[model samples]
Target chain A: MPDAIDFWFSTGSTYTYLTVSRLEQVEAATGMRFNWRPFSVRAIMRVQNNSPFANKPVKMGYMWRDIERRAGLYGLPVKVPAPYPLQEFDRANRVALLGLEEGWGKPYIVASYRRWFVDGQEPGMEPNLSASLREVGQDPARVVGQAQSDRIGGVYGAATDEARRLGVFGSPTFAVKGELFWGDDRLDDAICWLKHGRLVA
Target chain B: MPDAIDFWFSTGSTYTYLTVSRLEQVEAATGMRFNWRPFSVRAIMRVQNNSPFANKPVKMGYMWRDIERRAGLYGLPVKVPAPYPLQEFDRANRVALLGLEEGWGKPYIVASYRRWFVDGQEPGMEPNLSASLREVGQDPARVVGQAQSDRIGGVYGAATDEARRLGVFGSPTFAVKGELFWGDDRLDDAICWLKHGRLVA
Candidate 1:
């Protein structure tokens, strides 16, 4: 069996969107089977005692510039979303959970990221998401409805609890077997582990 | 007078240690005086709705790993300090405040970072700090005593409040004329801005 690549992500994360764009190509080239796992960003933050943008204006300013630079480097268009945190992740993540159940998680993640990052559409923005889903031949309303079901809720909760149990504390995180790789920047290292069964020293 | 570069920092931040070591060379090369300003990481996180560590085991795992990589990249010897966060920053920060007053903040920052990143000492670990101070011909006990004064405390508070007002959320952040740049990775870009007055498109 191919090594399982567990992808833990958040819909509102820009880095997650970036990683989603390239992960498939890496997986195909490396012969790794991806296991898409979506979880709540808020639930994980509670355990770490760290607020994401804590009191450094200079740093936040740098992030906008750096993300744009990285996006340009990756040939992706970047747009700063309104209402900064994009609180609509509730519905987006719920739908993603349903996608996981149907084994459509990988495609959903890619499409969602493309819509948000490449197309500059917000994932929580219904019209954009619906259109994007339809383009991918998915029934938007049905997928969304299924995302809100108790079954999907249970999946979301389980993924979140598992994240805590596994000591996950950030987005764009990946795991190979049991070894973990954090940040969008570490994707190559994750692939290395999957391919070699040990981290590069 | 040259445009002042705001050095946004936190008392307990590690990346700041690296930046401090190089600030003088950067300033001499670019001809800008860094306005050393300290801020609280806690306050910035509240506004961004981001916890420092977002909930993914891979992220937590990668942080330590990434730091090690960065230490190697910078040619700094690093040891994970005891008790992780090193809670005695109040005293250490007070000393920094005094150093700021004495116009020795730059050296103090460099020495402190050397002690931690190069010497593998914990922040606020007295023996290490004292030795570091002695290396710079500073009397550690006298400096520590001075750090406790009302004036230094006032400056520390003001710097923290200033950081919140400027929308700073993390460390080793750089600001030039109120333009904020977050993260240690952005130091080069910040220097570019210091020299060119804007980012190159």
Candidate 2:
């Protein structure tokens, strides 16, 4: 059991947007360190033959409303983009991996979420990607070059593999002491689990 | 928006078991009445082309662990029965409707959950269903007979229809003010929403 929280998320997840936006606040409040990890949620859901948005439209309607309401609760802005499930996560995820190595991971992730969810910008689309990196104080040209490198693909793939081994079938999963807590709703319990361990008899 | 909570659940769902066990506490604390609803999760899942335990063994593994952890947190005992996802909820649901009419719905639900999740008994199984109804002080023979009636079948089907109309795609869904909050985890938020309303800018 390590004294850190493994925060696993995908760039395209709406619930991940919630956790990403509020993670800084949670860290400050709990005095905890986060091991930020980015993975491909599509790959993960593939293993289970599941797609988040592949089911009932009625349920999806409620979910869209729920996310809006939750964002309002957190004072975060959101606007679902025109062309949805934009699997344009590869470049963004690669840059995020590079950002993690460069010590600007959190800000980069927050910017990426804001770009897609709040500003309705398509991920992996130019100007957006470069601008997000530069906004976080990273050199866009250099970071983007590194992000597009063959090496980053291997690294990203391994991270996705690691997520599978850790039993992370969903995005915004928080792992502490080898226990996995899935979904944004489990964020508070994940933090508490880190601070005091699992509730046991 | 009505001043009540619509509590929906599938007897065979593990998450629903969690909420069913704790609903009494919530009602006591919130001073709210629940429209205790019982419906077939399988019937609901079919509309979405999903099976609750379909092709997602890894996710299912995590879910089992999650339920156990939550059970401990709530000081509730649980033992996953052999051959799970017992879909014999029809008779039990019908009896539950009768129990609600008799003003013993909560106790009956609690007893039903205990039988399946704690005592490791199959749902709608002879001795178990009879014992649960009797424990809640209902006449077992009469309730069982009524539960198997064609009229009760119609009633149960209507409730399932109502759940779908209300956009209840999952178990342990809580509806207040026409807002559907799915999952046992959202029970607290649902209660708070009833108390304070949605947060808005």
Q: Model 2, stretches more than 4 Å misplaced?
A: A81-83, A139-141, B81-83, B199-201
DockQ of 1: 0.19
Model 1, position A172: C-alpha lDDT score: 73
lDDT of 2 by residue, A114-165 (tens): 8888777766666577778778887788887888899999999999999988
TM-score of chain A of each: 0.87, 0.91
- Measured with DockQ on alpha carbons, how good is candidate 2? 0.59
lDDT by residue (A1-201, candidate 1, tens digit) is: 567778888887767766777677777877776677789866777566644544544555555666665665556666754234665787788877777677776677677767776566678566667876776678987887788889888888988999878767778778776767777766776777777665453
For model 1, fnat equals 0.23
Q: State the local distance difference test value for candidate 1.
A: 0.69
Model 1, B1-201: lDDT tens digits are: 466778888767756766777677767977777888765564465565654444634454556666665555566566643234656666767777777777776677677767766566665567667876677678888887777788877877787788877767778678775567777766766767776765553
